[model samples]
Target: MTRDDPRHDVAAVVAALVAEASDGQITAAGALAEPDSLALLGLTSLGQVRLIQAVERRFGIAVEPDDDLVALDTVESLARYLRERGVA
Candidate 1:
């Protein structure tokens, strides 16, 4: 996929948020490119908060506090969310 790919942007955002949450332990784009779990990437509950906020801001959508975060726990899942939620 190109750099502008939705998944790529999702991965980039996920990587940045996870890295910030995990204290710089997992910022590699290559790793995030195929990452299967945000938990594995060190996304804590607090990180998920930042991620949600960032997603809302970057995607220009309102992610409810009661939304299913698990659906956003992976880059692919989030990409699907963007597609299905009519945000992409």
Candidate 2:
């Protein structure tokens, strides 16, 4: 799939994770303001694992340990991350 493919709904993925982790305090758009570090989101080890699983299932792709998602910090970052990983 191309970069603009509908299947690569990075905003939705980020929103889902933010909602799941923060109980709705952050949103897809709001996630853009998060620090450029994955740790700022309080994504614990378990949370990261869950997020990775969700992303994999949603995108129908396998996420390697060194995948771009590990460096993702913002919604845009996540979108580009998936794109770079050839998810769509």
Candidate 3:
């Protein structure tokens, strides 16, 4: 597989994961536009679980239960966090 800068590409992964988890209820633009408002993105309780799993799998990093959910609210923010962890 080809690789790119995680800083630039992480948003795509996050967007895809959110779309998959949300079942198309949210779009990448909408999610990126409002990176801090997850509720507005239609992320339900079940969707949250799916998103977390997707993140873990994509980044190969396990998210601890103590991790703040609020921090993963946006594609950009999530990408930044993952990139910081050397996921790129």
Candidate 4:
């Protein structure tokens, strides 16, 4: 889909994943500080795998197991990453 497509709002997906990772206790402000202040929310390596799986399932997209999703550290980054991979 095109970048401007409403379906390409990767931030929403990422936010959902972050909320899931945090067990729904993380608010928008909290998730934004993930990997730093929100490190206690279980955003670990295993959590990353779970997030990827969730993203794939939610979006009906197949992401390579080794795909570089680590760079998706922020909502904006995740959106750009999805766009670059043609998933958004």
Best by lDDT: 3
Tens-digit per-residue lDDT, 1-43, candidate 2: 5667743466656657655655554554566566575457565
Displacement of residue 86 (Cα, Å) in model 2 is 3.3
The TM-scores, one per candidate, come to 0.65, 0.62, 0.81, 0.62
- Candidate 2: Cα lDDT at 83: 75
Model 4 regions more than 4 Å off: 1-8, 33-42
Which ten residues in a row are the worst by lDDT in model 3? Answer: 1-10
Per residue, candidate 3 scores C-alpha lDDT tens digits across 1-88 of: 4565543577877887888888889876676677476667788888889999988987889878786656677777777778777877
- Candidate scoring better on lDDT of 1 and 2: 1
Which candidate order results from sorting by TM-score in descending order?
3, 1, 2, 4
All models, RMSD in angstroms? 3.7, 4.1, 2.6, 4.1
Q: Model 1 reaches what TM-score against the true structure?
A: 0.65
Model 1 regions lying over 4 Å from their true place: 1-23, 28-31
Cα misplacement distance, residue 65 of candidate 3 (Å):
1.5
Q: Distance from true position, residue 42, model 2, in Å? A: 1.7
Residue 15, model 3: Cα distance from true site in angstroms: 0.8
> Across residues 1-88, which tens digit of lDDT does each residue of candidate 4 receive?
7777754467766776767865676665566555433345546666666666777787677777587755546655665677776764
In terms of lDDT, model 1 sits at 0.65
Error of 3 at 71 (Å): 1.6
The candidate with the higher TM-score, 1 or 4, is 1
Clashing pairs in 4: none
